[model samples]
Target: MPLNPEIEACFEEMRDIRRHLHTCPEIGLETAGTAAFVKEQLDGFGIDHQDIGANSVLAIVEGRGPGKTIAFRADMDGLEITEETGLPYQSRTEGRMHACGHDGHTATMLTFARYLADHRDFDGTALLLFQSGEEGFGGAVKIIEDGLFEKYKIDLMFGLHNWPGHAENHIIVHPGAAMASEDRFDVTIRGKSGHASSPHLCVEPFAAVADFIGGAQSIITRMVSAHDKAVISITQVHGGSAYNIIPDEVVIRGNVRTTDSGVQDLIEESLGRLADGLASIYGVQTSFAYHRKHPVLTNSTPEPAMKAAARVVGEENVRTKELPAMGSEDFAFYMQHTKGCFVWVGNGMDSPVLHNSKFDFNDHGILVGASYFAELLKEVTRQP
Candidate 1:
């Protein structure tokens, strides 16, 4: 399917919005400016919006008759890095940038807002979710807590991400387990601080932490199935200030990612056991803290509504999953509550990777994503 004139024009509008957002990058949950921009766009199309979760904008596009209420969400947050792309529309705010291409995501949703509002001769409601704090702090969960479902009464939800690595427009999707669960860990070991010159005088926590970090790796390799993939990365370790003396306590922190929930359970259970045995052997005290967040995103099937829309965009542009990435996304939170699959829109091969200072969202994908959103509405909200 070739691009329609309406879709082509949407890309240009997206460029205008993207450049404005790129110049002013804001961070964290307080995206007042960003949310305001989205609200303004919806208003321009004569659509109504409701504010929820501090900075989140939720709008429902009510169509002609009754049908399944589908939702489309886009995050509105930026990273802490400064822009280095040196583009004419580069970020003006120092030490702040839309390095993750959220500006692009927001722009695409706005374009959809315009197109859908203009073509509202359909059935059912289309909910627009311009959410806050996707980078962290559990934004989606908060939106749900703020009565997202109760208000919109969404039957299905959909999300899209701009992927850098795959062939520019490959729309990957997995029926189940598209992303993993994220778990963070903090481990501390306490020992007797003593002079390094005196051998065996101090129960060395530094040595004990080192042993535990290494053992943490083995837990995945030895305990989990060989076919399964799980990672335990001890990213931070702080122990001693002086080489001459052993520190009384050593702190180690890391994160865990796994596709399998059973593996995550084993990780926590095994870590508890390992801590007990290590403390007894080294004659030191051990403490552990772990947080499990963002359950896996499992799509029951290729969202028939989204897939039909993908077909309208041509086979070459739409891609099904061969394999999925390990990186987690908060969109998973919405998918868990509704029966919809998150799709990946291409930002071209040469575009900067997400979160990189040089990264910028490819404007080429703007119309493609918007068209998908529009086409999805036509399919899902059609005459009976």
Candidate 2:
């Protein structure tokens, strides 16, 4: 379907909003300025809204008639990366950038909010959720704990993320397990510290760190079934300060990503066991801390939502089948409480991949995303 003229006309305005957000990217739950800007826009539209958590905003737009109440979400967080896209309106905040296209997500939701406010043709209420800390600070959990679902009755919910490496403006709506669950771990191994020349006197931890790193990989390659998908990555290793000294302690931090909760549990248990065995063998003390970040984002029942998306982007542009991604999203938290589907809106195959220093949200997706949300509101909330 072609873009609605009204929505198409707002493209430049949305682009401007996106650029402005890109210039002043905020990280995690400290999205005060971004929330303020979003609130200002919502207030201009005369929509009813309120602040949820420290840096999240929620707006309600009641339709002309009564029907099911639906919710749509947009994440409002930036990565810790420095701006390298070199766009005229690149990040003004040093060491912070919207390399994940969150700027576009927020702008698209704002545009959809405007549409919902101006034309209340649907039957029920539409809740607009502007969330923060989706990059990994557990903002979604904070909002839920703040009584987001308890205060408001939402029958259905929906969310979108910009996907690179796909055709521009295309939509991918898989039915289940759209993304993986993220669990992070930190391991500290303590040993006797001594000079490098006194090898016999010192029980150095460098060997234990090396063995743990190598053995951690073996958990995925050997313990995990080849049919199942699991990834254990040791991204950071810290130890010795001076070349002449053997450090007393070594700290290793990494994360595990899996589609199944069972696999997640297995990896965590195996990791702890391996660390303990290594510590016993090396006569060193070891402490391991495992933290589950985000659950797997699954669209368990996506047919209705997929059809709604098809109405806006046409069936040809909607991809119903695709492999699940290893990345994780906190939108899974929302889905856990309510029935909803998370989808991907193509950011263009040639565009820079997300989280890359050069990555930027494609302006071309703003209108399409807004139009999809608008159409989805109409489809899901129509009088039955």
Candidate 3:
């Protein structure tokens, strides 16, 4: 219950900003409007900022003297989900909404930036990244390509997401992997099409598709070790249009998630092998393609985050025992270059899960998140 008084005082303004951003939801890297709004807020607070990546806004705050430069990121893009929550500040966009709570994240960062404006006596610099295109968009990659890593000498980085199914006052930090890596695969099975009545005449592709689907699950259970975690989900399957006619080709698409890179490589290799096996066994031509989207988000330094969380929310509320999420985050890309950790602040126990149509970012979370970030700034930038 002990939150930063300055951040607590800005709750109403932070709520207003969150609600305003919620009303006009932007998607992917096309967050020109959202980035503009964030820049406007930074201007009001007299913080120096500039455009980076596609439309990501990066704000710089210089401290008392030179030390470890810490960076904090907040994703600003919304999902392509229609708002079903009957809140008055519901999304005005027809097919887009802030279902993932990025609005709240941006608002919380802005509130913390406001606090930073008044208090900058600490050591080192603070980089506040109001990034766009976190929803499967290469926003983080775009920023890096645009010279984020080259221009700035960042010593440490940090980020947070509002997670459902936990208390609002609770803070969760992972000891190692915080989120999974995302890989997508597609298998195309090609065969001759012929009359359904004459089964022997046509080389059916459904048989190969079935075997591939079943074999995918085996890759997780049989190939992957029991201790290591991985998931392969067959999300899409497309085949013949007519029931009577055997299709010439059947396409199967699936998603892969894993916490370890070695496991990721194993699953991708096993899936390709399974597809090749189908070609030999079913006498059909098979093509397999795999794409690695995001890498596993491993927390290199957990002690600083854990200490900061315990400082804001009591030690009992700062959780470290929970399992790492299977969900993937683009922030993992940032961690690949620098040392940092991503923590999850509870939205609320009753809050709707992320990406749900009815999901909304809990307002109370903004206060706790900003306060935690304020404390984290102190924790990481301490004179060592």
TM-score, every prediction: 0.95, 0.94, 0.98
| Shift of residue 228 alpha carbon in model 3, Å | 1.4
Q: Where is model 1 poorest over a 10-residue stretch in terms of lDDT?
A: 304-313
For model 2 the local lDDT of residue 226 reads: 90
Query: lDDT at 31 for candidate 2?
Result: 97
lDDT of 1 at 368: 71
The sequence of per-residue lDDT tens digits that candidate 3 reaches over residues 1-384 is 379998998899899999999999999999999999999999999999988999999999999998888999999999999999999999998789999999999999999999999999889999999999999999999999999889998999999999999999999999999899999999999999998998789888998999999999988888899999999999999989897999899999999999999999999999999999999999999999999999999999989999888988989999999999999999999998999999999999999999999999999888988999999999888866
Candidate 1, residues 210-266, lDDT tens digits: the string is 789889999988999998868888899988888798889998998888877788899
Lowest lDDT block of 10, candidate 3: 1-10
**For residue 38, what is the lDDT in candidate 2?**
97
Worst 10 residues of 2 by lDDT: 375-384
- Candidates 1 and 3 compared by TM-score, better number: 3
Q: Which segments of candidate 1 are over 4 A away from where they belong?
A: 382-384
The TM-score measured for candidate 2 stands at 0.94
Stretches of model 2 off by over 4 angstroms after superposition = 195-201
Error of 2 at 90 (Å): 2.5
